[model samples]
Target: MGRDRANIRVDLWADGDWRGLSMGAQHLYQQILTHPTLNYAGVADWRPGRLAALTKDRTAADVQRDACELTEAHFIHADDTTEEVLVRSFARHDGVIRHPRLHVTMANDFAGIASTDIKEFFAFEIQKLNQEQPELALWNHPKVQTILKAKARDMKEVTQRVRQEEAMTFGSATAKPMAKDPNSVSMRTATATATSSKEDIPSSEISDEIPRPDVDELLDLLDSCLLANGTRKPSRNKKNREAARLLLDRDGYKVEQVAWMIRWATADEFWRANILSMSKLREKFDQLKAKAGVATKTPSAGFHGEIDVEAVLGRDVWTPGTPPEGLDVAGEIAWKKEQRNIHNAERLAEAKQKLGIS
Candidate 1:
């Protein structure tokens, strides 16, 4: 040989045969043979002829050196009852060729190693071998490189498709319109308009249009009527009496009419006394006229004393210490005319009683 190192080729022997084998196969064979009951007699018998044939192509010295190299390589044991052969090619640290061998024996002659198990075992061993001797370029073969690349591309395509589908679904959901009934907008607008109109209406306008009776006038009439009958005490305030008298004189509502409007019974003593003055209308008029120095010029019973001038005007025509004016004179004239009727009625009643009228 030109160079002994270059010419060196490792020979793997199974039992005694020079077989081409893998590191995984060698480890598996060793594991099988380690079982005490495993039979290797048939394999050992077949090995010598195979070894002889392998060496026929090589010089004796080279073959012997290769066999020695193979023997020195590490061996891993597999379980007994495994019957298969595995082989691989590797290089030594010094660049010498080493072929590993596998010889599987059945510890109990039941079954052989499964193809999937063999393949998985081989793959694991190859990975280990690559780790141990990274410079070994077995995984760099074209077929293995092509298969790995194809698997990577297929995985990438599958991932991209899944992401694209997910994104499309999400976009469609977000873009979908919210459900709205056709009439909802119109209803909302109508409600809002009604609410705004109600808010804009003023309370004062509503109050002014609503009709009700004047409570003050009704109450004053009740007080005056009750006092005139002696059914209630006379009002202590002169102003209240004057005010009530003025209101009644100006309106001249009939007793029954006043009672009906004020929801009082005409038969009630207080109602009859206040409006008709059954007690003292005549006497009171005379007293007031005397105090005011008003003269009763008529000898006829139609006229009596000075009238309540302010009472006829429907409000006070003169204040205390205030001199009478044109309006007061007019009010006095009207009051006098009303008093004359009352005095004539009284005189007529007296004349009727003298004649024993029923």
Candidate 2:
């Protein structure tokens, strides 16, 4: 049986995650919670089009965008591969562990999940909850272990720790990386590639020489580019490495040229999400180069002298660091001034607090 009701606290409005969301996103979250198809495991059919139809003015694209915002906020998880939406904390919040009989339904619902990514993420959430609330002792339950075992979407079903980790590394071709790896500079790119099934560059294409740190920066640059756009980071393990290698070794693009192209493609509103991997970057390099040339030579004019900076730079979350390639003198000055203003604001707040001002 599906969820008859979900436990939504009245104080939900005061929650940090909830308070930070836009009104549309907040409404979408509520609608999902009360959705008829939401199962015992808190997974609901990912039908944004249908959800959109429920409201008078909401469009499918609006729903999709709000869902993306929610996913990025870590309050929920959406996997297009499985076409499923998961309320990440639902298992704990549902109080299922308090009722032993609910285990059967929870198991059945979890087993029904087609996405291994969701399964892994949900299982981690449950284990984490158990750790924080030892009284739950979730794993100690006999059926709990069997229930949380990730059923492979591609290969044989596995519950072994080794197999689970292996599945995580190479399970879904299009799966987003589960965790950030600290050891690698381009962690997201490496993880995404390691798990991908489509090998654009063959094993034979792999060079005998390890990529230099400078070469690897190409991969890192792609990761940063995506992050700057607030886009989901694709693992860069193979697709990034081989594509970058080919660009340098075979296609004959210099490191600086490739780096500039990386920023160029990623800075475009349309291309940033599309050109995820280094392989994809290589595929679209020429087109990107051509378009970038046009944009640079003639900055798109806005009303009067004002320039639409966003048109030039994709909605990247710019930070205090190396400015993106192709940023004009005016743009650089604006960025620097914004940073200085932020610093001044902080200083003002500190002084006010020290002076016992409200």
Candidate 3:
């Protein structure tokens, strides 16, 4: 039997794949995630008969079909010969780094509950992962190694349990280790900051235009708009801060305006998928503004209702007959027709103003 997991963090943005899943497959995925056997190892028996019992009114065949669906969707991996399944992203989803001891217990528990074939498969898988690229090997994960280290410490201090508790790695608040880039300066903070005294933090990453909380607020907005990869600050600090500086100081955009742009871009179907980072946002700001239907009108350039159609649309708007050089005949005709409409509208507006019409 496996241990209980009280709750699992569900990242709604990352799990957009769930929306397209069949109801049966969705149900099966949920059952597997919450199964008692899905402990620290995140591997469990893929026995259709056993899982079928959990799915109300569903047959073994149905469970099998849904299992296939899950496998195809990269949600779970199952071996036909061994009848064992491993949740691919389980360790990541469960924050395994924070619960190293639990993983050790689950790996140990697997020997008793799992069949011989399943156990053999897991061993083989771990061995292959080790021989090929041990860094990515499931058993050799940092968390697992951390657990082994803690266990060794415990055995050494068997007679001093209180001391063991104090020295334990998994459950201690002060001892909790955060993932960090080895090259980057490590600055563990409960909240985001605009400036850092650390030598590793480049001057470019810091911005004086926006306060620390404001930068954090923009980060929060980006996190909501973007999918986070198991980190508190989702966007790269240097890129994000640089983009913010451009928006706030160079471009002369208000904080509220930048905030609105974040909201609008994230909410837009096209822009949402495109604006993954603040740097990308700053780069495509003009295009996004145009996409948001910001077509500003300009004063008439010529006396004969002639207008700079390009200026009005913020881009080249081919007018009838006089299309920009090298435009094809058909494109010229299209532009001419569109230009006629604009000319007529501009003329009407002029007439109204001359007559003092409201």
The candidate that achieves the highest lDDT relative to the unseen native structure: 2
Candidate 2 segments exceeding 4 Å error: 147-358
Point out the worst 10-residue segment of candidate 1 by lDDT: 178-187
Q: Candidates 1 and 2: which is better by TM-score?
A: 2
lDDT by residue (1-358, candidate 2, tens digit) is 5666777878787788779888877888989999987877778867665787799977554566676556545666665434578887778777777776786667667766766667776777666665687676556666677754544221112212323443454464423332222111121122343433233455575564765676688888888877776555655566567778878877787787787777767765445544666766775566666444423332224212123334433253544565457643335445765784675455534544554544
Total colliding residue pairs, candidate 2: 8
Per-residue lDDT, model 3, residue 203, is 51
Off by over 4 Å in 3: 109-358
Identify the superior model by lDDT, candidate 1 or candidate 2: 2
lDDT of each: 0.29, 0.59, 0.49
Across 19-108, the per-residue lDDT of candidate 3 in tens digits comes to 767788788877888887565556765666568767577654456557656544556655432345666555445654345355555555
Decide which is better by TM-score, 1 or 3: 3
Report the alpha-carbon TM-score of model 2 versus the true structure.
Answer: 0.45
Report the lDDT tens digits of candidate 1 across residue range 1-358. Answer: 0111222134434335335444433433443233232222111111211332443443222222232233223221111112222222211221321222111111111112222322333334334444676664434554333322321112123223433332343243421210111100111112232332233222333343343244234445555655443344323332233322333443354333333332222122122322222112221233323432235332322123223222222222221232235332224334554665565455545544554543
Worst ten-residue run, lDDT, model 3? Answer: 182-191
- For every model shown, the clashing-pair count is 10, 8, 4
- Best candidate, TM-score: 2
TM-score of each: 0.16, 0.45, 0.32
- Window of ten residues with lowest summed lDDT in model 2: 181-190
